[model samples]
Target: ASHGTVHPDNEDWTCFEQSASLDIKSFFGFESTVEKIAMKQYTSNIKKGKEIIEYYLKQLEEEGITFVPRWTPPVACKSESSTSHTRRPVSPAINIPDSATKEGLNNKEILNTSSSPSEPTAGTPDDKLDADYIKRYLGDLTPMQESCLIRLRQWLQETHKGKIPKDEHILRFLRARDFNIDKAREILCQSLTWRKQHQVDYILDTWNPPQVLQDYYAGGWHHHDKDGRPLYVLRLGQMDTKGLVRALGEEALLRYVLSINEEGLRRCEENTKVFGRPISSWTCLVDLEGLNMRHLWRPGVKALLRIIEVVEANYPETLGRLLILRAPRVFPVLWTLVSPFIDDNTRKKFLIYAGNDYQGPGGLLDYIDKEIIPDFLGGECMCEVPEGGLVPKSLYRTAEELENEDIKLWTETIYQSASVFKGAPHEVLIQIVDASSVITWDFDVCKGDIVFNIFHSKRAPQPPKKDSLGAHSITSPGGNNVQLIDKVWQLGRDYSMVESPLICKEGESVQGSHVTRWPGFYILQWKFHSMPACATTNLPRVDDVLASLQVSSHKCKVMYYTEVIGSEDFRGSMTSLESSHSGFSQLSAATTSSSQSHSSSMISR
Candidate 1:
């Protein structure tokens, strides 16, 4: 409500257009309680709220005595009438909703405003994100996770030309890569490219499994878990995997799996709305009652491994839990063959049960509501999933025909592999044009252990030219050339280490980033991973303790890439990277030297 217009000569108070704003974020759906409390607090102190205003009012006039107007009901808002200070009811008592009542209400009115100071910006292309909405719509994430999503999403929106994923989809990749935005970006970008190339986004519409998958595929969604996650039931024991591959071929089977995952994401979204919480992942119940050697036939196992790789890379963090019930005696053989392919994070979700042990404590009942459990599992619910059967010999495809699907699996191979020898390190020279620009890397150790390090030198480093070789990749420096940077130039005096030496083990896909301070030559060096036999002070001094001293017993293989993001693109993202410096903290901090960010995955990123 506005105060009356001021008369310059008679009045000491100035005119105001609007009253002081009152902000209430949320009430956890108990809005009435908030209104009731607000009403009592404001109206009870009708005169009390005016203590300061009353003091000022006395200064304007000769009389020190003051009077405050009576409080008006919430419904009696000021009418939009000119030349009148009268109040009018917004609506009748009977017509008024429970959200507005006569028992002292402080109803909230949403303002028509362009933007709010309190609302945080989002990770979308154009719209600003609200932090509260992210916390509610996504999982409860740390500030680092939130910041990483914002920065990475912004980068993708700017860089990625095709359809960018939704914020929640991007969040999965972030979670998969441990919320390292730079790493997630590298992985997500590659996945997005693969999706566009292979049309994974349109799989739901364009792809359909052969009739064999529909009748013989032993998986379908059951009711929700106790925690409200959408649950999928897969009878692996009953599933004729070899038969399906023989009938539909691996391509058809793989496409069917993709379609299921796409459907799962859709169901998860629907469940999120149904349950009124973020549900980005789904629980799975895998029953292996008759899992035998026949199910693990070599050809079937190969197809299974291919399917696993595709899913793990493209659909990370999607399995909320996997309840493996009624595992057969041969289950260990299957697990041994497939466990390495599954990510450590994903593998942790597997709860294996041999025999009829699922009924015991820490089993299916712990995750699934007893009432919703299927009748076959000793619960009352009747499950409608197909009872899988083997495909006949006439349906089997030729061995030559199965060869066609093997070639399309190239979508997952985004990185080019290189061998890093012990003494002959794999070196890449990065020429920084601007200071404070972010340097990022994403790579996987495919064969052996390797130590990664970055160094900056004033002089340009000697490396192969950029067309035949990659722009930054070091495919063996010129044989007769001097060291990448002058060896005489002291470590601290001539060049400083940008990132600490990172030791990467086989099967670990590492991603890291650092903001450059100086515009000069930066050499990213990866040497065969090694450890000294004993303490080094007694022996010849080595600059880096983790640096490899002797020639490696074997060559290490790595697939890697590097890029530079403008300072402006990653301006506010450094904070998240700083807190993520899990091990790259051997160097002293500088104004422009960003803390190293480290993240890894089991699969080739």
Candidate 2:
């Protein structure tokens, strides 16, 4: 609406702009032009007015305010008691959703909720703006912020068909993105998709940690913090990060970490009810007493960074605070590698204490209850967290085994089963980009005897152009085998044997690795092992007769898995380079430590 009014004495309908100084006496000189401008302005103002009104309505809904019809009649009902007591009308809990009614109950009710960890809750408690927690960490939202939350929830509901996350969860994402609806919705939708794909909703009931993790993982949930937030203690310094990565591989470790986060979210909801306040995030205390260079193993660090990236993307604003105690001199290097991936708001929550700094004033006691502090940190309470030690090399799995195990978590086995005929061999081509890269294989001989060989070629082999159905066919024999090497190629000229052929018997399992001497294409071949014509004699012994029968079958079956790892991340993961023709010796613990030390030096530089 225009601010200036038409002069009473002006018959030409002259108008002056109130804020503009250079306006003519008759700004609206023509009636048609004035009407056109007025109509355009009216349309824009109407749209703006509608948006403002919608925003106000959303704010009212958020505050639990609803306008009932004035013509509605009062209900006639019998009171619980016959006494003349006033029956005051009670307003629905302000800012509380229907799903949040079950939370923030007494301690006994919290215990009951804990009995079913996987059971879906109505909703988490809404941390009202009046709470001090809201004013301190999660600032009180303005009307615009509330509007963003409302828009985000509606967007999710339209896209997601499953149970919608509570408003609090949606609000956390909003705050994480600084109330930017587009950014917050992007990450939130991605997280929801990830949760659905991984079946993370039922992780508590479905996932069972392996025994190694149960005995060796150095982190666990402790008591609540001073602000009623759940507390988690991690003894990172004492943990063998290399051992865990090697033992479990990156995917398994990632899944374990994800489960921990899911469990933490559950605990947060429970604490919210028990504390009678909104506890949306958890507090973590990390003890870095035994930190050293060994923890900087390349593969381990890579795994940690991947886990951090995932957590930061999906679980934003879930870490209320992070306390670092007994920070070692080497901590700076690790921090340099990790801190860049953390969110700025999350980084602000971190409090660092070097050496015995935590023991003095303004330390652990300020945030955690004195009696609840873990005994390992000089407090009387004994923490149930494991004192993780080095995992025995005997428990470590081969690279191929680890890869298969990791794949199984997200899908089916990576291993493929193939039939090896007497003439047609099953071959797989692997391209190595760097020399000293480790190529590892694990295969089981499911039928007759077979021979495994590794060959390196400067030029890639062209696979057979067509599939033929026979034992002597150039392509797949039993719909599985594939022969890659050409018959016209000479071994000495076209390719070289990188490892000696190893003959494996029926029902035997073989696992081996070879360090490549040159970067090129490597083919792993499983060939049928035929016995000599004269080896079996007539009227032979029982074992000889059985072997003759097996050889006569002319077909062998093998299930195998293979993986190539960069030399930098190899980390001496394999115990032996059992078939190396390049004079490469067995990979040992000392070699692993040396590689990690070199990598750590590079990081520091």
Candidate 3:
């Protein structure tokens, strides 16, 4: 081959290396003027070899170089009546009538007029349309809609600092608010503030649902819908709402629901990539086959309403559609309770079916494909949703206990709670190997009255076994109440009183410490305190009599935390040493006066 000559083998050109620049003179051996023209053309088509030669030949003709050009004849754009001219065949997908009738000409005219790529080619007047629907980053937005998005983004940048969300996310809020910039900005900012306050944005990473919820909560993500939206199946009918409420309370359940929504948002993003389309929202299939009166428990209803309120406000427009399947007669009652909290736009997306009506046409099949439909719904695919049953009565918690849990969740504190029943006191056993070490405690008697006592035992009590309900609830009716002192052990022989018993009334807070006098196992106990039969017999005041007849006299609730610190560290702090001896020196006015001097036990703030 000649120097700088191009060669083609098997229809592939041996072109210049991409790293090399296009040198027109060296490659084509042209004069300065022609080379300049060729260089200008090569700048755009540097990678094209044959196109450059064709372009150079045309340029050569203009520069007084004569060459016969090989050109194909142009096709005619006439109708079937033109006999002399030939036309290219049209694609079969396009509709074109062979007969030269007036209707055919009219149809062609209509097609030509609407040939712009922007016109909708399908659907009828009854179909609901979203004018702002975007695909592959291309949105068909009106000028006003585009302007609103730009202005809203600018406003957010100016008014707020930190990180801004993606434009698509902002547009979701805009679409949610009908592109009303003011309303969208207000709600988006409020949602951002709420997310920060609750740390909801980090919920998927931070919140871990309890094992009970994971094992019993009846919901999970399934495959994508026909439209590429993520699908989530919730078997609400089988779930034991009352049981979950009593076991985990409302806050934990709310946290778990928030994590679900967060995960749904993430799956939408993932499915968008996998399906090669814009998927900003998800589809939810809710099965209510076994829904009954039990699902309408008051606490559970309240929790559901709260969840709806939060999700509606923060995750607006995130649900593309909701398919309610096998809606029982009881569903109307629930809908009446929860519908008011649901947004009007979201309500429009709901497609509910009664009984086995979902199995018919325009049911789950309309949104979900036949193959991925769950087996429980008569589809081939198997669903991994939990078969939620009644939560164990053994795991039920009292109102006061649940309240304490809510406080701990909100405050993010390190406090453990316990229930104290009449015969079975809640006791924590601490093994102290070194004398003079300090055992400190802070406790609040949240409900009813309780007796607090510290006992020292030479022998350790059997360690409590880990149970599903948590804590030792072997002997008590309420959860978290555990008894460590053996029934056969005598008070004087097996364990001696290390601190005088302190009676803590409801709503009282106590902070105390005890210095170890011996190397032994120490037990801190909270016992349900009641007036003796003799004491309550002749109560002088009516209030006192009624107080003695309180309904919760047999049960008590306490939230407490305890720590054992070595004396070496305790000696360095004047405050701790002072706090340690404060209880021994004097008791609070709320506590009964004791005759014994227990120097080892102390109470302070």
Candidate 4:
């Protein structure tokens, strides 16, 4: 029996079963008709299964679903593999928008692909030609010029910030084709000509320093010092004087001078021959009297005494009264030497003899009696003694109270007479020195002679000379003698004495001869002898002295002692008085008195 299943559609199999008589017998022999029926049934089920699969596949195709089998044959296994080949599919072309196409065209590629006359390329001969052309034309131009052309090209770009015409690019390009640096610079300068004209006009219109007299004055021409410092010279008295008249008008000058003092106006009239001039009526007489009283007289008196001690050390023969000449010339020269020191007819008689050749002699006396005496002895006068002599302040309550009509007349008469004569009369000059017990000579101008000569008296100790070994040797002073500190100490002591009233009063008569003495001349003489050498040396420098008195930092007082014998000690006592007045709290009474005595002894020695 055949074991293979038969299909239900195989009609031939049924027929074959009936036709094969031998097969039926064989079939009935082991497995009868039932076994054959079973085989046929199995074959029919297989055929039905195949038909159902085919129907489902057809339905899926109609519904647009693809059916793929799980197992697939390799390419090598396919029959068409040796005869056919596979290839990738080509992509479709993209359709660009019209706006994008237009933009691309407008951009116009700067890199030229064609080997044409206009194209630029690295390998092209035209590139070589263009470079060669640039080398030939711009080789002579500086780096600055080359940079400027490059900047100019950048400025011509459409995106540039300036408002140059679009056609400027074409013009620049044409110029570059045949460039010349000098011509380019010339064109640039021409473009700025209008600007230069506007600048010139602006400068001229705004210029200053106008042409006028006042402008010249303000510009610092007339009254400037040599180094351009500002200077103003004020005229004090007799403004109608030539100097004043030239600077200010005659009327203004006269008015200014008269305003200083009514006495000045009167003096101008009396001494018209002396002060009055051809061009102007007035003269400039610096008010030196106040300056003398304040600076030179009071302080100078103290310095004069110190100077006398130093002078006496060398010139032992020089009398003590000789130092009195250092007193101021104006007051002393009048009272002590020139005119009589009496008030009544004595002064008038002297003036009458003195002014004989000039105007009425009696007129001189009248002028003195009225103007000169009142002015000198007035309350406005200020006086102080140096080293405590008979100070005017101590003699009377005030200068006004101290006024002696006789002394005033005497002083005025002498001043008026002296003023008439250019120099002091010979008789008067002699009396001044004689009273001070000093002999004087008029050397040089006779105006600068002080009563004592400190510089002449003291000689600086000699220094050692070199020995044979070429080393200098000095002699040391013995322990018994005082050791001097410095030359300044010596100089200080000398200068201080010269400033004392006694010395200055004496020195003034001898040196100036222009001054006469007052009644207390002997007191000043004694005071000079009493000032201590150490105290003199300890006094301040002249500059400080001037400054102190001017600022009132140093108060000056004059104490009087009647007895001439102890007057030197009295003057010595004034050193303490000055220290006290100066507000030196450290000063003790013992130290003060001791220092005063010590200072006086040093001067006496």
Q: Write the number of the candidate with greater TM-score, choosing between 3 and 4.
A: 3
lDDT string, candidate 3, 181-277, tens digits: 7799999999888888898878887777998899889999998899988899999998888678778888889999889888987887677667655
Q: Which candidate number would show the highest lDDT if scored against the true structure?
A: 2
Q: Looking at candidate 4, what is the lDDT of residue 225?
A: 21
The number of residue pairs in model 1 that clash at the backbone is 2
- Each candidate structure's TM-score, on Cα atoms with residue i matched to residue i, is 0.48, 0.50, 0.47, 0.14
Better of 1 and 2 by TM-score: 2
Model 2 clashing residue pairs (backbone): 104-273
Stretches of candidate 2 off by over 4 Å are 1-139, 403-605
Quote the lDDT for 329 in model 3.
41
Better of 2 and 4 by lDDT: 2
Q: Tell me how far the alpha carbon of residue 403 in candidate 2 is from the true structure, in angstroms, after superposition.
A: 5.1
lDDT tens digits by residue: candidate 2, 416-449? 7788877778899999887666666656687888
Q: Give the TM-score of candidate 4.
A: 0.14
lDDT of 1 at 600: 19
CA deviation > 4 Å runs, candidate 4 = 1-280, 283-327, 330-458, 462-605
